[model samples]
Target: MADYLLESLGLLLRWLHIVAAIAWIGESFYFVMLDRSLKPAADGDAAIAGEQWSVHGGGFYRKQKLVGAPAQMPADLHWSKWKAYTTWLSGFALLSLLYLSSPQMYLVDPGVNALGSDQAVLAAIALMVLAWLGYDLLCRLCGFREGLLGALVALWVIGLCLACTGLFAGRAAYLLVGAALGTIMAANVFFVIIPGQRRMVAALGRGEAVDPVPGLRGKQRSVHNTYFTLPVVFAMLSVHYATAYAHPHNAWVLILFMAAAALIRQFFVVWHSGKRAWGLLGVGSAILLATFAWLAPTRNATSAVTPNSAVAAPMHATELPAADTAEIQKIMKLHCTACHSAQPSLMASAPKDLRLDEAQQIERHAALIRRQVVDLRIMPPGNITSLSEAERLQIARWADTLAVDPAFK
Candidate 1:
């Protein structure tokens, strides 16, 4: 019952997070496009940097780019901070519900490093805070030089990816990186961008000239947020693809993927101004192709016995004896029941309601077991159950045999 309630809460929070992220990203993209597409006014005004005319939803709108704070402050000013705030809040809630609440099952992998639940949660929190602080400090020190700052930040992220993968499960590490980046983006709005705008508005109200530095700084952070969008989206979506995160060098996979996403974002950013960025697209494609080639899943034989022991040839499905119902039930009990049974001791809930305790239940889930265990090798997540290659083949052969048997129905 507790698990069911948490699942429902997670769903609600995830929905809210997605909706808020969409709104924030849309606003960001629209403004970036507008900024890039702006043209000098026909009748040049000293205070007008540029202007854009557009039609949306059967309504025409004209927007002016002010060279500085407007001479007369508008009575009503719209702010874009709330969308960012809501996204971060909802995302954090989802993270807590899904990961922090069940660290052993979702966040920690004994193969990576044995991290107690409390230690892992504390590390995750520290990662988020430290990432934001490092990024903020880097921008403050060198953000005036765009190219240098970009290079430095990229290095920092790459280092962080390596560190995270070393400490946490691959999927968790990727999500942590995304959460940190998202926090930086939102913090930019809350701590730097919005505050700067408010100060400008205050000066405008007092009939005092606004400092251009704050506006320039805010623009820098806003542009950084745009570059982060594609990478963060990729990180969020990568949870579904276990192959990428389940590899030995999953950190490299993540870093390369994020690099590709950033390059693609750059292509779009430049393309918005009628500029061709084919080079960026080409580089991104090459990175993705290389990643796919390197990470393709293929079964290989590596003897598990001691070096002094005689190594027997690996077994093939054809050489193995026929796997009957009894054999299938035994294998399922040995490998899957700890977490998939009705009264699971290892996990708070039976994942996906995949109970393997009964014969009928195992037969009913035969196809799914084949996919997750035989094909993907992604179940028994983190290989926590110590599922062996021979056992996986046994399950596969059993499922195939069951498919032809009339009793399987």
Candidate 2:
């Protein structure tokens, strides 16, 4: 009952997080597009920087960007801060409920670094906090020099990626990086953008000359947030792609993926500004293709027949012996059924409804098992079930046999 309740809460939080993130990101993208698509004011008003005309829902609208505060403040100005706040709040709740609550199973990987559960949770939190502080400091120190600041931020991101992959389970590390980026985005809104807007509004209300510095700062942070959108979204979605996260060079993989996402986003940004940069798209596509080729598993490798035995060299799939179902069943019972059976002992329900209590069910998911258990080695997360290497190899051998058979293939 407790597990079920927790699962339900996680579901609710995830839903709320997604909805709020969509709202925030939609607003960000819309504004960025509108700004880029704007033309010079038709009447050449000194106070107006640019204006755009658009038709939506059978109505024509003209939007204007003022150089500074208008002569009079509007009575009911809408603020965009709440969506960002809601996204961060719901996302943090979900992170706490899922990863922090069971750090042993989700966050800490003994093979990577044997951090205690509490320590792992603290590290995750600290990463998000420190990321925001460091990024904010960099913005303050190098705000005038955009190129230098961009290089520094890139270095910082690479360092964080390396640190995360080294410290936690790969899946958790990816999610943590996403969370860190998300924190920085939300903080940009809370600490810089929103505050700057508020100050400008306050100044306008007081009949004081509105300072342009705050508005400039707000624009800078908003641009940063827009660039971060695709990368952060990719990182968040990467949990589903074990091939990327579980690779031997996962940090580099993550960095490359983010670079690709940023490049693709840059293409869109340029396009919105009445420019074409096909090279950006081409470069991003090349990176993705290279990464895909790199992550493809080498299937010709030999597997250990047992824990005490050694295979002297790699052997082809055809040369391998047929798998023993009884042995496979035993291994599954020991390592997988706890969380993957019809009545999972460790969770409210079998994850993804992949019950392996029956032979037919196990055989049905053989390819999936091989990918998760053998190729990626990301299942039984954090090695919580202590799945032995020999057992994994056995599963791999079985999967390889299936690959060679036409019916199974």
Candidate 3:
């Protein structure tokens, strides 16, 4: 019952997070597009930098960009703030519910780190906090210089990727890094962008000459947010793809993925500004191709067990027992079915709906099982089932035998 309730809460929070994120990202992209699409007004107002005309919902809209504070402040000004706040709030809530609440199952892998649940939760929170502080400090130190700041920020991100992959479970590391970047993005809006805009508005209201510094700071943070958007989204979605996060050198995989995302985003940003970005697109595609090649599963070339043992060492399918269905079933029930069954005893749902309740079901998901269990070693999450090296070899042997089955081909 507790698991059920927690699952429900997780689902609800996930839904809320997605909705809020969509709203925030949609608004952000729209504004970016609008800004790039703006042109000099025909009836040039001296205070206006650019203006855009659009048709939406059967109505024509004209939006103007001011060089500085207008002669009079508008009484009805809309703020694009709550969406960001809600997205961050709901995302953190979901993270707390899913990972923090069940650290043993989700966050702490005994193989990766011997951390207690409390320690793991505290460490994760600390990382998020420290990430925000470090990023904020870097921004301040870099000032408004885009080239220096971008390089420095990229280095920081790579450092965090390495740190997380070494310190936490693969899945946890992936999510933690994502959370760190997300926290930074949201805090940029909450602390720098919105506050800076408010100060500018307040200055305008007082009929004082608004200082350009606040607007400059706001624009700086906004640009950073745009660059971060795609990378954060990839991190959020990466939880389902075990191959990326569960590799031995998962840190490099993350760095490569982030680089690809950033390059792709840069391409779009430059293109939206009416610039050609063939180099960015080509580099981004090359990175993706490299990542895919790196993530491809390779069969273990060596086995740890002796030849005379009941379980043969990891080898080609010809060496494996073809009629070991009963033994394989026992292994699945012992190590897998607790979480991957229709009536799961340990968790709320069968992850990815790949159940192991029957032989046919197992056969259907045979390749996926091999990918998650043998190649990536990400299943039996957090090693909660204590799936041993021998057991994994056995599963690998079983999976290898599936190649003879036409269905598998």
Best by lDDT: 2
Q: Note the clash tally of each candidate.
A: 0, 0, 0
The residue-level lDDT of candidate 3 at 342 comes to: 95
Instruction: Compose the digit string of candidate 1's lDDT tens values, residues 363-403.
Output: 88887787676655556765667777677667766776787
TM-score of 3: 0.92
RMSD in Å for all candidates: 4.5, 3.4, 3.8
Candidate 2 regions with alpha-carbon error over 4 angstroms: 301-323, 402-409
Return whichever of 1 and 2 wins on TM-score: 2
- Predictions in order: lDDT: 0.82, 0.87, 0.82
Residue-level lDDT tens digits of model 2 in 1-409: 9889988998999999999999999999999999999899999888888999999999999999987778899999999999999999999999999999999999988878979999999999999999999999999999768899888998989989999999999999999999999999999999999999999999989999889888889989899899899999999999998878887688999999999999999999999999999999999999999988877666434442211111123445565555755667788999999999988889999988999888878877888887777666787898898887667767878776766773542
Off by over 4 Å in 3: 300-323, 405-409
Give the worst 10-residue stretch by lDDT in candidate 1. 303-312
Which candidate achieves the best TM-score against the true structure?
A: 2
**Candidate 1 error regions (>4 Å):** 300-325, 333-378, 382-409
Clashing pairs in model 3, backbone N/Cα/C closer than 3 A: none
